[model samples]
Target: MILVVLGTHELPFDRLLKKIDKQILLGNINEEVLVQAGHTKYYSKNMQIFDFTTYEHMADLYRKANFIITHGGTGSITMGMKMGKKVIAVPRLIKYGEHNDDHQLEIVKQFQETGHILYWSEPMSLSEVLRLVKSFNPVKFESGNKKIISLIKQFIDGA
Candidate 1:
């Protein structure tokens, strides 16, 4: 199963959905696709689309997914990364009204540069990126909270 996540942003990320739908129509994607469509109101017979879902439900979907294709939201991208899942992130560009700014571009680029995820951007088709997923191995994600807590504990002990 392939999980597509569009975070809880008000803007419609129909652009990404359309691309995926095209792939399905072309038979490039033969697996089941589950989508967390958020505010993007799109109907696709090829996919199971949900307007919104609880955190627990989403987590379950993430676990069941073979890999994830997600918008360039930090939370969504990191969730897939932290789960050790291969992530293909597509940034929501301002020119398309998918986002208010191009910040998502930076976020996706950083993750891609760090070897945490692959990204779909201009001049690269999603199908091209999808073809790479079979061989992509994401770097494991380690939360910084543990290190922060350790530092605080050491400070208290010293004091």
Candidate 2:
């Protein structure tokens, strides 16, 4: 099963959803698709979708997912990576009215550069990504949040 997550952002990421839907319609995706649509209003016969989901439900889906398709949210990407799942990160771009800026693109790029995830920035065929996944070996994500924790400690100590 392929799990598609749009996160809980206010802006709707119908762009990514549409692409996935298209691929499913074209018979490129034969597996079952589960979507956490968030604010995106999309209807697809090829996918099982929910407007929102509980944390427990989300965690269950994560565990069951073979590969994850997600918006470029650090939390979602990190969670999927930490689970050792193959992740495809698609940034929510400003021009598409999916975000206020292209910051998601940068996040996607950084993750890709570090071998943390695969990123698809522009409109393209997901078939290529699907094929790549068979041979793709994603690097395990190592949390680098200790620096922030140290900064917080310094501030608390008035250092």
Candidate 1 lDDT, tens digit per residue, 19-111?
Answer: 999999988899999999999999999999998989999999999999999999999999899899999999999999999999999999999
Per-candidate RMSD vs. true structure?
A: 1.3, 2.5
TM-scores, all models, native as reference:
0.94, 0.89
lDDT of 2 by residue, 1-159 (tens): 999999999999998888888888878888999999999999888899998878888988999999999999988998899999899999999998999999989998999899878888676557787778778899987776998898899999995
**Cα deviation of 93, candidate 2, in Å:** 0.4
* Candidate 2 residue pairs in backbone clash: none
Q: After superposition, how far is residue 133 of candidate 2 from its true place, in Å?
A: 1.5
lDDT of 1: 0.94
The list of candidate 1 runs beyond 4 A from truth reads 156-159
Q: Model 2 Cα displacement at 77 (Å)?
A: 0.4
Question: What would you estimate as the lDDT of candidate 2?
Answer: 0.89
